[model samples]
Target: MATEALGSQAAAQDRTAGFGRLALTALRAVGRVLGRVFGVVRPVAWVLIAATITLWIAGQSLGWWELTVTAVVIGAALLLCLLFLIGRTAYDVSLDLNRTRVVVGERAVGALTLSNTGTRAILPSRVVLPVGNGRGVFDVHRLSPGEQAEELFAIPTSRRAVVKVGPVSVVRGDPLGLFERVHRRDEPVDLFVHPRTVLFDGQSLGFLRDLEGLPATDLSPDDVSFHALREYQAGDDLRHVHWKSTARTGHIMVRQYEETRRSHFVIGLSTSPADYRDDDEFELAVSVAGSLGLRALRDSQRVEVRVQERALPAATGKQFLDALSGLEHSRARAGGIVELAGSVAASLALASVVVLVCGTKVDANDLRTACSRLPFGARVLAVVVSPAGTAPSLRRIGDADVITVGALEQLPLALRKVLA
Candidate 1:
């Protein structure tokens, strides 16, 4: 009897748990259906609906003619709002930009074109285009069948960035802020606002590289620059065997060559926020690095640009500038110039010139320490970008020549004076 009683109690408990799970699933399904149907309704509409229901119930129960009339008026207004949302729209939208790349302080002009494709006309609606953090709203008039309308918008550029400019949305709703329905019509676009750069004579800086790279001291079995003849080793390639030397010396002789220098230029730009005094100083540092890299590229030299996070693409002028336009300062815990130099040294073992771009917060000791981590024969130039209004100056650290640049325009003059 006792065992039967325990079994019955367990059976009842299991049944109750099963019922609870089934009820929860049903409620979830109902909630999702309601969410889909009423998702576009505004909060004020819901409030008005609830008030109408409550007032009608109270008025009918209390025999108050005034309450009943007020409820009817509110209900009529809400019903009229629904008519505004009951339109079918078939639009072919296209977004066109005059140019996708621009320099700082230059406005980016774009046009949003809409055409009515269906047989019926499209009612007047609002079009919203997102440009970076802000948005522009335009009133699109009624577009008849086969009729096209165009709206122009200009995004102001105050800083360097890669601004996302589109995914144009057409909004349909009443003017009373009751209901809204949005349809995405176009794809997004990226507008690159390149950093300001100055052109300087790279050869005047004495960082030139020969067409055929200069020979290094390291000897290799296979290279272009011949160093000397040596006795043939076990793994020596027979193609490099010196027949004349072998015949004269009566021994197996092979040709040895010195490794040629890699004439690539490297730019290490410090991105730590703590290293900069303000946003302007950081921007100046970025511009300084960009100017140096552009000069190197114009000179037809290989360039490798790096920041605290990673190395940027420097294959062409456009790619380099696009990458630089998207750069932002690193977090507080990010490394400084010393760590940046270390990373660049590890990634690129050989370079003709390594330029360190930083702010005035970096001291001489930091520059010296950073210079020690670079390749032995590579020339180091540390460019310190200070706030505006400060005089430009030049000095030499232990192994790196430091140049203080106050503004962007002073970069070319400072580089010529310091490096020449």
Candidate 2:
């Protein structure tokens, strides 16, 4: 009898567990239904709907005429709103940009095209396009079957940035502003507003003129550029042994060569906002870095441009400029120019020339310290951009030559002095 009682209790518990699971499933289904219902309903409409139901309940329970009348009015208005959202829009939409890349202060033009692809006529509606932080709303007229409408829009390019234009959406709503259904049309496009760069005579630069290879002061035993013969070291290669020099000196000698390094130009721009007196100075520094990078690309030299965060792509002129457009300055969370130099040294160990771009707020001592972190035999040039109206000047701090540029126009002259 005890065994039978235990079995009966287990069966009861199993039935209770199954009932609980069914209850949870029902709740999930109800939630999904409510989610779909609320997707097209605005927040204000939800409040009005709740108020209507409450008033109706209160009026029926307390027999209040005024509350019942108000509830009826709200319910009627909601039903009217539902009538406006009855039809679905079938549209063929496309977004076209005249140019995805522009310079700062230039205008970027784009067009949105919408066609009625349905068998019936469609009512007038509003189309919304998200442009960066702002929104553009175009009133699309009623389109008949096989009819199309086009709208032109311009994006502001007042500053250097990467602006996202679109994921064009068609907005359907009622006149009461209580309901809306948004259908996304096209993929977003990125608009690159590149920094203004100055063109200069790149061939005149001492470090860049060498096309074959630059002969470094450091000596290597198995290099192509022979320097001089030296007494054989313990680990010297046997092939490098100079028999003629050994016969003349009566001792073993080996051929030593100066290390030949392919010209690699690296531009390190500081992204720390504190390094600049203001935003204008930071922008000038960016332009300077861009000018140097473009010149390097023109020279067909291997160029790497980077900030405190990551290296910018420099494969082509357009890519380099596009990456520069999105460059921004922030606080020095990962240290400053010294850390950037270390990173470049690690990534490009054979850099022949390294240029450090910063603002006037960075002192000479800091510039020297930053330059000290570069790879050995790499010639370092530091460009310190100042605010407009200051005269361009050049100075040597430790091994790095620091050029102070006041404006974008002064960059060519400042670089010329460095070459001189």
Candidate 3:
């Protein structure tokens, strides 16, 4: 009897669990159906539904035939609107950017091509494009079968950013504003707007001097400046042999010349948010980095630009600017200037000078610590991009020169003082 009772209890429990699962499955199916039904339902449809419910309640309670008839009419209209807005149409859209990358303040233009691929004429519709945080809406006219239309647009490039443009969405709606449908037509494209760079005429004067007749400590046999005579090695160039010294000493002696060191600048930009007081300060720092790198490149010197862990490849002209355009502030609290210093020291051994571009939030101690990690004899410059209204100042942290600029317009002047 005890075993039979136990078995009966187990059977009841199993039946209850099975029923619960079946009920959950039914609820999910119903939810999916309702979701599909309401997904395309517009605001007008919702108002109609509410009015229908109210009218039906009144008709049942007060036995009003007029309210019942009115509710049925609204219900029929809603159904008809949904039927017209549910089907897909044959339309194709293609976006072509004149250029995917451009400098700040330059015009970025593009064209949108719309084609009607179906047999019937496509009714007038609105094309919506997602541009950055905003939307672009263009009214498109009716297109007959095998007909096409093109629209031109210019993307705003007043600031440095990576702006996303479209997955083209074509909006179709009823004339009565009862229902609407959207068809996604194209993939998104990225436009890179590079930071603005200042053009400066003065030469860089600090670390590595000009290769034209510049004296240096390191001696080489192939350079121009004569240093001392040494015993000729097997691989020494024949032209470098000092014939007078060789004849006097009765030994093969080659002329040694001091190697002229040309400046190779490596600009390190700290992207950590903690290093910047705000977005404006960060943008100023980026512009400073770009301007300095461009100046060095203009002078025909080797340049390397680094933001966070990534190093902008060795490039000049548009390619270099394109790399700078994509620089963004780091969301994570990664190590700021100190970490950047360590990375630069480890990787760029041949760098003649290091330009550290940061915001006003960094203090003198942080700057000093970062400069300490740099290779010996490398000139270090710390540029602090301060907020507007602050007075510009110049100071030194150990061997590194620190220059503070209140605004981007003041960068050229501050750079002259530091670089001089």
Candidate 4:
């Protein structure tokens, strides 16, 4: 085992050495090309040389030291610009980041480390990095031989979702800063922003308990629960005659117990123009629907939701929230509560409770007619999510139960009773 370990270590060392040599070779090659280009500046150096000589010759002999010093200075400047400065080249880049999820208005910081691996030092002019909204822009002025610097910025987010943040660009600039050269790394990172959740203060909802689902009580006509006793009637089934009750009452009594079964609930959303002129009312309706659905789901009841032409196919926790987030005010009038009820009735296996989430109010007569259309004994619940700035109230349309919800958040309670 020891022998094998030694061999692996040696191989790793060789790989590292090979990679370093390859990088160094590339940098050296680039440096040589740059050095050759700087050679053209020899003419500028010569001009400075001639100017210095002429000044000395015009009668500054008394300043021999100054002339000698001037010659030396020109020589040094020319050599440095032509030989050393342009040849300084090294290339290295690295990145560091903080937490992924950040507050919308908070600052996010990141660090970048750049190294010039060549024998010559490199001055990188431009570094472009993508920052989330609200994060101020950052600039890296220069990258010395091996420089690491921190960048400060803020991220501004209005909503919650995932956003991909980028592959940064490393730029090089000429000595005069006239032109910038850029190269990019192929790195894409993602950040998740949670939804903007709001918590209402001091909210009371009594209607939430009447949530619709398969009814848990003995209310259905086809159920088996004992409801009450009544005196025997002409059409009373002989089998249902309560002989024990009759003996006590000295009258022919019959069992009139009500049967209970699963409460069937159908939620229909109306997106008709006759319903709401203000978009807020529509949004409120959507919110009420979401709240109502959640409440019913929590109760372990089977609940179906219907929205005219707005078909949302989400069936999971977060999926529903995401779908609801995309809800918008639609005026297509593709279907109405009455039509939705009919459609739902056709699909249900048993009689169901119908609940309508509508922002617009329809004519009372039409509503009454719609209610009359419902199958016998199938209850109708109309929940109005009105944006009329008034407290909610309840009314009746024929045999149907109608309740108004002032706020979208109060939908759960209002629907519970209406559907229940």
C-alpha lDDT (0 to 100) for residue 68 of candidate 3: 94
- Which is better, 2 or 3, measured by TM-score? 2
* Cα-based lDDT at residue 257, candidate 4: 57
When 2 and 3 are scored with lDDT, the better candidate is: 2
Full-model lDDT for every candidate: 0.87, 0.86, 0.83, 0.58
lDDT of candidate 3 over 148-202, digit per residue (tens): 9898999878889889899899887776777777778889998989887777768
The segments of candidate 3 whose C-alpha lies over 4 angstroms from its true place after superposition are 1-39, 43-67, 86-88, 105-107, 176-178, 204-263, 387-393
Q: For model 1, what is the C-alpha lDDT against the true structure? A: 0.87
- Report the C-alpha lDDT of model 1 over 123-204, residue by residue, as the tens digit: 9998889888989999989988899899887888999999998789898889898888787888999999999988765562
Write model 4 residue lDDT over 80-167, tens digit each, in one string. 5443233332345565556555433343455655555555445534566665442223455555554555554444555434555656
Please, what are the lDDT tens digits per residue for candidate 2 over residues 292-384?
A: 888888888888887886889999999999888888875568667778888888887888889999887787778888898888888889988
Q: Pick the candidate with the highest TM-score.
A: 1
Off by over 4 Å in 2: 1-33, 204-206, 230-254
* TM-score versus the correct structure, for each prediction: 0.88, 0.88, 0.73, 0.46
RMSD of each: 5.1, 3.9, 8.0, 15.3
